[model samples]
Target: MDSIEPRNIPLTPGVYLFKDAGGHIIYVGKAKVLRKRLASYFRPDKTLTPKTRAMVRMAVSVDTLSTTSEKEALLLEASLIKKHRPRYNIVLRDDKQYILFKLTKRHEWPRLTLTRKVVRDGSAYFGPYTSAQAARDTWKAIQRVFLLRRCSDTAFRNRVRPCLYHHMGQCLGPCCLPVDNARYRAMVGKVELLLNGRSSELLELLQQQMLDASEALEFEKAAELRDQIAAIRRTVEKQAAVLGSERDMDVLGVAETSKGLALGVLFVRGGVLLDGRNFFWSGLGLEEAPEMVLSFLGQYYGPQSVVPQRIVIPWALEEQAQDGSALPVMSDSLGLSDEEVLADSDDPLAALAEALSELRGSTVRIGPPRGDAENRLVTMAQTNAAEEARTSASANVEEILAAKLGMASLPHRIEAVDVSHTGGRDTRVGVVVFEDGKPAKDQYRTYAFTDEESGGDDYGVLAAWMRRRLESGPPWPDLLLVDGGRGQLGAVMSVLEEAGCGQLFAVAAIAKARSEDSNRADRRKGGVADSIFLPGRMNPVSMRAGSPELLYLQLIRDAVHDYSLRRHRKARAGSALAGELQRIEGIGPSLAKVLWEHFSSIRDMADASEAELAALPGIGPAKARRIRSGLAAMRTKA
Candidate 1:
């Protein structure tokens, strides 16, 4: 069917799929009242994320699966999401870009190091500090307070005497010193507690120990303990601990944006907010906001995941009322009676809370946090999530794009270059300029990259254009944009560096993520992201889909692409015309033109006999034969 009216879908619990013209599912969603949720999409006035609007614009039909209960619908939706890996479903598995602290507990002398990935090894891992600087600050604090050994295993084994760190009082001089392993291990334990948001407990022990040392008249030991306690207290104050409970709780907050969805999860233990990690995802979809939030939590807290005592989220529980809508949608397969439904209908925390409680071997509370302290913690998480979303969703596109892509400054005067290759040949390069976020058409330029083979290497052609511009020393823009990815960016950066102007200007490269899968669903034409790649980063910097910055960058790239294509076509057309004239022995371009004017068509020329050709003013028998032969070869090749 070309269209699916909302009324045609089942009203009960189920999953829905929106398919494009090729019958490929672009978006997957679940709802308790299927028709109600999906109807919102077809309404013209309802605001939608840019990605969702794009999906709806492309959707040609809809499909659904009726589930007995909403929980079943949630389960089926999660399974389908993983199975199809739909482009619009923001399932988390690849969003882990946070810096973490890893300590190899398996090692005899473990030194904490920064890492981005957490493995299943026995070694302890803590933190997902959203940035490298944040992780570095935590490490610096530990060094200032703990004074533990800070050396690689190899260095620790090979040192002959106390190293500079030990002499500087930054390390305990474990290497080439009579150190007690028991005391070192105990100090390592304290570091572990400190890193995991259990600093209050460590502080209490430290204060007690300090008092004992003072009573024993050990003034130096007492002073050291006092310093450590102060360091821990400073860290706690900086983190903003609004709650005072020892129980571990994971406060959750999420926000949606055109760039993507951001979820901030703050780890709170021993009544202090130790650390928070923000996971970002692209594909801001049209799934029911509440159900999608539930799905995100389900995927985040897997069966094997360590469940905290509470999973605080900034969402209202819909199951609070006796006749709460969620109750009827739950399947009888779970065997819930009227009493059970009301008992947990406050279950607006959702069914996952029960599962979490079972997994944690204790009751787990999941709901909109109550009380000033708990609410404040949830608010903190929400603030982080909202800020992250703003970075992607900001209306200040140019400024936000500059910040998101890690540019040196706002790209007020920007220049972007693109390489156009047709049939993988006859390449041309174009440079498009934007002044104050608008195209500066008079400054645009195009060049033919006629290096027979260089046309295929976008990097090589971009390099050539960049090198030419650098050598000639034209007025530089605040930022330079390239139409390819990391490789082209690296080439352009190298050219600028060789010219001694690498650090003088900012540069970034944009590449559209191409699908290797030829299937229609994987074939994202206008919908695919044009990823921006910057220097010194392994991952491409992300900008929102419809962000002003992205729109500006795309506009420049498109302008350049259009300019290059025009030049390439003109060059190819000229080459074809020249090849015909160059093939004949005596007929130069002028003679060919005169002959062409006389015949008016190649067919007319081919039809004329050799004698008629010889009678023409510039055409003799020898030249006529060559022209005839060349025409014969051209037709044969065709």
Candidate 2:
């Protein structure tokens, strides 16, 4: 389908995109010599990596956009990749799936849900949590400290009776009961206070309220406040100041292996190390240190990225660490290849900083950290990256297997897929990873189906999920292992075909043997065989259950199932409990949701003064009183 002949192409600097049959852009690139680069794909005798061949095969058309110079083309290519996320442009993507806690004011009970992106929607999003577990722990603590509903709108609507969470005292049975809207709103406030990292202010307010209640002879209210104060203090004491300055900055450190380069970003906010992230880049020929560093800076500081006035690279502090000794001696220790020598006309780092400065409407500096304390911080970031790359040296797994996987070099990364659901509800896809035969736990990601209708369709769920992931692009695995038989394997292959990156990675499927002639007793003992299915094969490749390849596949499958199943159960339970708040007479679904977002719990919502309740739209003075009366009745029932 690739109909364009290379001879027809003009020699010029420009960016080009390869589009699939559906007119979807699959790959984006830039070329100083368009004819030469375009001709390389058509050369029959020239050796082509499987990845390049795959792109060429699926591409039905090539669309070119000419630029004035190569630098302009380079910048345009980066921007297009960011927008289109063509699968081949892996060097600039950071799709690590950090957790973001979302609380929407649109709901009556604004319970927290972990989301991936921070949208401009009115809801508040707190965190770039390094892992889902960290976000889970924070959400759990918030629920434990303040009993907010953990159910979804759908679950809340269908409840006939209070669920386990309500009985366990983690939620007030707002559904199927005469619930208090005002009290629920208060619980939402407490959770927000904790998430906003205003624990000290929260503690002071609780203390003041407790004192007020005591003076009013409300002993029970005072006691509850006292406990809340203690909990806040315990949480606040755990976050120690990690830096000497309160100025916010991003610290960058680089680690390199012969195979690839890794960059560690330490997010320093209010001088506290809140979260850390690592990004990897390879195969764009970033062999030279300066070019790699510049590329990293450009991609990282692009328009959408959050930026501070100053950026610190570890090598910037290399000289200071040596107490003013020459730069070269310190550079080597920091994994920096050479002194800050500028050989090329294109100053990408400067261009990046300039673009950032334009966006920020202020000058932004990209260089080393300034003080003794700052220098130590940069060193810390560098060390973190070094730890990640230490294992990268072993990223080259068994070479034979890598070749089979159709990798350009060796398989440094492998991602396994598993989908778990509860009766077409809360379906979640798990993307688990292994690097050089060892687990990469931080990279484990799960995507829950947001559509209720798509729960039962595993093939559809996976295809859609994989497509979205690839479109976000990068950190693409060298190999893929689907947790099913040929059906799932074929589904994955078809998805890769649609994305135009099928030949880039090796693909396989793992399936448990059918009973065939075996009895129930044999099945119970794990006597059934495991099958490994490779692409282009009619039947699964033969491998014994005890074989290393089969066993490793089993481990990956087990982990994905476990990881996804656990989250599914929790989400299902939460969705069921959150629906309860809508039962309040004065509040409908929309009002209930907003109230949930605004207030933390039933008690908080019920205790809110009439004036405060009136401030919320649609809740007039009469409805406010009704809300209070309902809360009082619910209080009596509980």
Among these predictions, the greatest TM-score belongs to 2
In order, candidate lDDTs are 0.69, 0.66
lDDT of 2 by residue, 450-555 (tens): 7564658888888877787777665567678888778888877898887677765678887766666763222222233877788888876766667555566677
Q: What RMSD value applies to candidate 2?
A: 12.2
After superposition, candidate 2 runs with Cα above 4 Å error: 1-94, 105-111, 147-193, 198-201, 204-218, 234-238, 244-250, 279-367, 391-400, 403-407, 412-550, 554-638
lDDT digits (tens) for residues 433-552 of candidate 1: 775555666677876666575747877777788878875543456688887778889888877787777765688887765665752222233334778888778887777787666777
Local error of candidate 2 at residue 190 (angstroms):
5.5
Please provide TM-scores, in order, for all candidate models, with all chains considered together. Answer: 0.49, 0.53
